[model samples]
Target chain A: MSAPDRFAPLPVTDTPQERGDAARNRALLLDAARRLIAERGAGAVSTDDIAAAAGVGKGTLFRRFGSRAGLMVVLLDENEKAHQQAFMFGPPPLGPGAPPLERLIAYGRARLAFVHDHHALLSDAGRDPQTRFTGPSALHHTHVRVLLQSAGTTGDLDAQTTALSALLDADYVEHRLAEGATLDELGDAWETVAVKLCGR
Target chain B: MSAPDRFAPLPVTDTPQERGDAARNRALLLDAARRLIAERGAGAVSTDDIAAAAGVGKGTLFRRFGSRAGLMVVLLDENEKAHQQAFMFGPPPLGPGAPPLERLIAYGRARLAFVHDHHALLSDAGRDPQTRFTGPSALHHTHVRVLLQSAGTTGDLDAQTTALSALLDADYVEHRLAEGATLDELGDAWETVAVKLCGR
Candidate 1:
């Protein structure tokens, strides 16, 4: 889930009334967390490492985010929002001004790439189906539904979108990968399903 | 998984070397395990309950299945084999007597229903993607691959098969159900995907 909404609630750092120093401190820690996650993966980075990397004490880390998981969720949400914005408003097929069918295909490719890149954090955050489906996934589904409508397709768009979203599930993607299915194979299969459904 | 093969090497009782009494004792415990799982759900049932219900000692239960999780895996394997047999040999549509498209639709419905009925046990047994994707899922994928071939569709049948299988994944199905998608909705979506993929 990309929204801080589903994750154990946003940390105290997210409250609008935070002091300037506290806000900067929160940003510093989050920046450090994101860089460390990118470098070594989400599962490998610890709160202790994050605090050390951010040049802060562990107490400040805990005080701001409550726990390591909370920090990870918040940071992941940032990534999710960025992905959503890129597709919704950035440019080209993934953004606006492209054919709906093209956007749909682009969306699938981008989402598959997203899951592959951020699987560790996504898997850890999406412990429940609700969280897993509601946050970034819900946004993705709505995007697909709109694209399908714009593509001049008919029939239960709700169900269609849900079924389509199922293809990009992080756990499913990871499962396939763990079983030796390459990213290229997943992308090919996704293209097959997407093109068939879009009637292109 | 549909195979008893991947789940801890096919419990001791499955070997032909078992004496009549040992076979009977194994049957008793297994029957008890199934009953308890069906009645109260797998999560609520324990080894003690199965042992007591089967009129055996807890040690016998462990000796036969190794552990509680092991027992659940074996019990689930039994269900998977039954499902596999029903689809592979039993009757029209679901069995070998109908068109591949019809069989494919029937397979989706049967698998969805199977996951619904056994979610508790299957979820408990399949703690890893390796086990979940390798066993019964492998057989199901092969079944779908053959159906896709028979329907005369071309284009990476292996990858196409994998994508279609993702639509029926137990975790995906359960996730949709948890997110308020009804079984009917899931079935409809499956029909849409199957018919579209099969071009029937």
Candidate 2:
């Protein structure tokens, strides 16, 4: 069966009528939030700190992102979108113009790096099982499923996709890193699994 | 490095000096909780309902297990111990006598079934990332790591173990089931991945 058209760019849900300064304020808040989170960790960075750093009123922060969790979701979404764009469109291996097996290996490495880097934000954004498998995750599932199908992976495609995707989960990746495995070691292992699964 | 002696049976923390009637009451309450949870779902079954169904007072239930969350931990521990025993000491492929690759494959299948069966209880017991990588999860990691080492699998055994264990996670299993994949299909996919990783 053909894969569904699930890779269309995520919907741009921002209101179209927002004035220029409103958009600027939104960027300022997200930038400040990301910087604070990087310095102090997600839990330690409060909404008030984020607003003060952005030089905006706390009310502006709320008006832009609704709540602290909302800001987290948006921050995570931005990073996820950039990562998605690289894999979906940017260059060889991780994007296109490479053999399926090679692309698959590259995809795993790239995804491991992305999860490792954004572990804090991604973990804070969603732990709900219902939401875990939807949105960007659903798209990720489709991407891996299509790649496996192309590479002639013979068993259940959906299950294979789920298996691969699970390896890149933010929590799992963070746990491994904490246990003293380097990111390079993880990327190499992921490549090994990808090659084996692709029957290379 | 030798695998740590992490597979020793989990410590039995129950107070050994309890009276026979207290032991019976604890058993009664746990049985009732399990039955009610199986019938109406874990979320639907309340502490009051469990006490009422077990013919025990609400105070007795609290005195026995401390709180609803504590009861859930004990309930999940009971199931986990049984699973651990089966794999560690019970019989063959899932136990000891079989080849390492075959045992790994069997382990994955058995673990998938265990997660699928107990998804609700496990999902409710702990979603905290800190708690996730400890306790039973840590033991599982060691088990799979030892199996991979025995199988002579090359490159980053820890990462490979994490990859395999992540696939059998409760939330991942539940999400796949919700998406309509069968347990058998998951097992087959897991076996395929295990065989490939083991170089069979």
Which lDDT values do the candidates have, in the order given? 0.77, 0.81
Clashing pairs in 2: none
Query: How would you encode candidate 2's per-residue C-alpha lDDT over A13-102 as one tens digit per residue?
Result: 476778889999999998999899989988788889999999999999989876676678788887788899998998988898998778
lDDT of candidate 1 over A93-133, digit per residue (tens): 78899998888878888888898888888766654433545
Worst 10 residues of 2 chain A by lDDT: A1-10
Candidate 1 displacement at residue A137 in angstroms: 2.3
State candidate 1's TM-score. 0.70
DockQ of each: 0.30, 0.53
Best candidate per TM-score, number? 2
lDDT per residue as tens, model 1, B1-200: 66665766644437888778877878999999888877987878888999999999999987876667567777778778888999999998899989998888888888889988888776666554335555556678899999989987766676567666766756677877887988877777877777777765
iRMSD value for model 1:
3.1
- Residue A20 Cα positional deviation in candidate 2, in Å, after optimal superposition: 15
CA deviation > 4 Å runs, candidate 2: A1-39, A45-71, B1-39, B45-71
